[model samples]
Target: MSEFGNLVDSIEIPLRWGDQDAYGHANNTVYFRFFEEARITWLDSVPMKTAPKGTGPIIIKTSATFLKELNYPATVQVRTYAGKAGNTSLESWYEIFDSKTGVKYAEGYAKIVWFDHETRKSTRLPDELRALAAE
Candidate 1:
């Protein structure tokens, strides 16, 4: 358990040269990608059953707040945490830090909704996913 909630997962991603912009720092959008990677990794690790058409965990909303500029030649660790759960969605949080220095660089949030592809509508959050909420 951590401040954000139950520690779901963490991953280290090496910053690529293309990730940086003309300012020599990572673009804001890149942080969102880092968050997405960590979040998807966590979901994949969960041994949950597949729904119809395997449609699941669609991100309804996502946000990232930059605390510090990210530069290349560095490895960033993105930590994912479980947050609150709703009827058809769950909230997840993220923290990005320098792997070597442990200096936090960004924070993020994402709301994932369980959806049925055939129905093309939101569905009830699975018990396994709902259980991921902080208790």
Candidate 2:
């Protein structure tokens, strides 16, 4: 198994009934939202001089793997870590695990490309972002 950085950030989300499928387990698509929360948590951890210039990395790809079932009446913890921060893109990994068991219920990764909003084109990640991710 690839050992990633320690728990960089986390978000607790309440389980909604609608989050479950007919089988009474959390729907597969809902895992993406959990991943989103983790990403936002990581972004929140990194203090910014400005609001990312509203033109930095943008989500380009995402994938999820389900390991176990999660149901309503349960609170989930989305743990986050930086997997690979590249020159033109970065990858973030997430684990939605039971807060008590620490057992991962689901996991996923997202790849994002840095973009120049003004030009509407992709660009290499800024040095400051690279440094922040290094930590």
Best by lDDT: 1
Candidate 1, residue 86: how far the Cα is off, in Å: 0.9
- Residue pair clashes in candidate 1: none
In candidate 1 the C-alpha lDDT for residue 85 amounts to: 88
* Candidate 1 lDDT, 1-135, residue by residue in tens: 887788878899999999999999999999999998898889998889886476687998988889999998899999999998889989899999999999999999998898988888999998988888987
Cα-lDDT of candidate 2: 0.77
lDDT of 1 at 16: 96
What does candidate 1 score on TM?
0.95
> Once superposed on the true structure, which residue ranges of model 2 sit more than 4 Å away at CA?
51-53, 132-135
lDDT at 113, model 1: 94
lDDT of 2 by residue, 1-135 (tens): 246544567788877889999999999989998888778767767765553556666899999889989978788888887766787877778888877777789888888688888888888776655664533
